[model samples]
Target: MLSKSQIKVITRLKQKKYRVQDGLFVAEGLKVIKELLDSNLELHQLYTTVSFDGNLDREQRITEAELKKISFLTTPNKALALFKIPASKTIDSDQFVVALDSVRDPGNLGTIIRLCDWFGVKELICTTGTVDCYNPKVIQATMGSITRVNVSYLDLERYLKETRSPVFGAFMDGDIVYKTDLPTIGTLVLGNEANGISPEIEGLVTNRITIPRFGALQAAESLNVATATAILLSEFKRKG
Candidate 1:
């Protein structure tokens, strides 16, 4: 039987303010919860309708009716787990990095994190205005890749200014990424959905690169930020 207080706490975690205050976040589904359990993140509690084999110290078996009440998803998965938000590590300058300038979509941010993992990019830096990586939607979109990638939110402009490696910003008017020689170690900056890179961050970009359109008319205004990130990461890795 789930207690009222437990239900209330789980419901509050859906909001960013409460999540921040508690320093924890909720992950649903068997796969996501298992992946998080295997990773370094500490599990605060696990509430499940089905039997799970891993760490039993904090496990609670709950009924489906109770699960439906606490779940953020329209259709609740068999399980939901609360995991401690790990501390952000210092930005490592040795490897290629990806930075975001106010990208607000949770799905975009999640996909970008997965891309970073797939492409071997070590760290993802996001501006304060960017969507929180811990947002439930973002975590769901990421699947299990969130555990493999390092995401840090900070003042992107200041971080750009201080970075020793060259900074590359994605722009429509910039040199074609395929034609440009990308360095192995540099910061690839991607901007917001509607707006491109902000003026302040753009000023810090050492190089501006673009993915060219192959179609005859070139009618598309811009690539989706996550798609743009995939292409850019491939180019950088290919050249390096």
Candidate 2:
């Protein structure tokens, strides 16, 4: 049975401040919950309609009506689990990394995390302004890829400056990505949706690259940040 206090705690997790205070975050859907269960993240509690085969003690079977009360989604999934936010892992400067410069959209950040997972890019560095990876919307968008990626939020410009490998930034009037020689182990910095790369961060970019549009009309203004990330990552992976 879902208690009043339990409902209060779960509902409070929707806010970033509350999540930080509690040192936990919520993940919905059986798939995401199960993925987290298999991950290094510790499960604080599991609320679901059906019993998943495992430690029954940690699982709390609740009605769908009860789930709706705590769910952030309009259509609640079969399960929602609270997982402890593990300590941030140190960024590995030796490998390929993806850095975000104030990319605020939760969906975009989530998709980028998935992209990092897909391309075998283990470390993701984000500016303080970037949307929190643990945001319920971002967690939903990541599917199960969140468990495989190491994401860190910090001062992106300073991090870029400190990196020894070549730093690349995606820009509008930059050299074509396909023609440029991409390093197997380097940092690729992507900017915000509206502003693109900020000037402070721009100064730190060792290489400025862009994906050229082959469309004859060129009607589209720019690719979505996530879509652009997909293309850039594909190009980089293909070369290596």
Candidate 3:
């Protein structure tokens, strides 16, 4: 049975402030929830229509109608869970860090986090303006990669100013990334969807690189930030 209070709390988690205030974020679908269950994340609660093997104590079996009431998905998945947001770990500045200059799309940020996990980049730094990593949409898009990436929100400019790493900012007209000598350790900065790197962050970039267009007319203005991230990170790994 879904209590009014439980529904209220779960539905409110869709918003960032409520999530922060409650110290919980929601993950839906059997796959995502199961992956989270296997990770170090602490489970707050689990609502489902069927029982999970060992989590029967925490699981609350609810009807499909009850699930639809609290679910954030278009077609509710078989399960939804609330997990305690883990504390942000201190950024290891010496690592090959990926920085975001206000990338606003939840899907993009989520994909980028997955990319970081794939490429072994341990830390992801985002400006406060960037979407909350714990946003339900972002969490959904991460497909459980969120557990591996250490995402921290702070003043990006101040962090850049203090670091001695070679900052690489993705730009449309910057030098082609293919030819550039890439390093294994440094900060790679990606910017907003509509707006590229912000001017303040751009000033700190020691290397400005771009993925060049190979099409006949070169009509496309730019690669999507997440796609660009995939290409650039691949190049960095290849050259490292």
Candidate 4:
């Protein structure tokens, strides 16, 4: 059984403002919870439908009825957890970095983070306008990759201007990526879903690259940001 206060706190965590206010974010599903548990992130609480190994002092076994009251998912997963929001770390600019310019979709951001983890990209930078990485949907989409990726939100333009490494921005009309010289140590900027890279950020890009279309019609307007990210990261790793 969950108390009303507990219910209120957990349900409120679905919203970003409340999450920021409480200094905590929610992670649902057994896999997601387990991955987070293995990480250094501090667990504030855990509610589960069944007992499991690694149960902590703060763990609570709750009925499904109670879980539904606080769950953000339509079909609640076996477990849900609240973890203290880790403090932002300094950007690791020396290694390959992936930056986003107002990429608004939660799923895209989440997938990109997982992609970064897959390609061994150490740093992911997002503009303040980008969706919060801690958004529940984003957290769900990331699965476990969120634990390994270091995500930071900052002034992208200033960072690009200050960095000595080459800055590459994705665009429709830019030079084909395969032929372009991609350096291992540099910044790759991905743009919003509907709009490609913004003009202001485009001005700072030392290299402009694109994934060319081979179809006879060339009918498709653009690749999904997440899909484009995967392709670009693959190329960057293979050829950079």
Superposed by TM-score, candidate 4 places the C-alpha of residue 116 at a distance from the truth, in angstroms, of 0.3
Shift of residue 127 alpha carbon in model 4, Å: 0.1
Summed over model 4, clashes come to 0
Off by over 4 Å in 1: none
lDDT of each: 0.91, 0.92, 0.93, 0.93
**What's model 1's overall lDDT?**
0.91
Compared with the true structure, what per-residue lDDT tens digits does model 1 show for residues 150-230?
899998888888889999999999999888988888899999899989999999999999999887785877789999999
Please identify which of the two predictions, 1 or 3, would achieve the higher lDDT against the true structure.
3
lDDT of 1 at 204: 97
Q: Using Cα atoms with residue i matched to residue i, what is each candidate's TM-score against the true structure?
A: 0.97, 0.98, 0.98, 0.98
* Poorest 10 consecutive residues by lDDT, candidate 4: 213-222
Q: How accurate is candidate 3 locally (lDDT)?
A: 0.93
lDDT tens digits by residue: candidate 4, 130-200 = 99999999999998898899999999999999999999999998899999888999999999898888888
Model 2: lDDT equals 0.92
Residue by residue across 167-206, what tens digits does model 3's lDDT show? 9999988999988888888999999999989999999999
- Candidate 1, residue 180: Cα displacement in angstroms equals 0.4
User: How displaced is residue 160 in candidate 2, in Å?
Assistant: 1.2
- lDDT by residue for model 2 over 1-240, one digit each (tens)? 898999999999989999999999999998888888888889998999888987657899899999999999999999999999999988888999999999999999999999989999999989999999999999999987999999999998888878899999999889999999999999999999999999999999999999988777757889999999999999999978
lDDT score at residue 132, model 3, on the 0-100 scale = 97
Task: At residue 191, give the lDDT of candidate 2.
Answer: 95
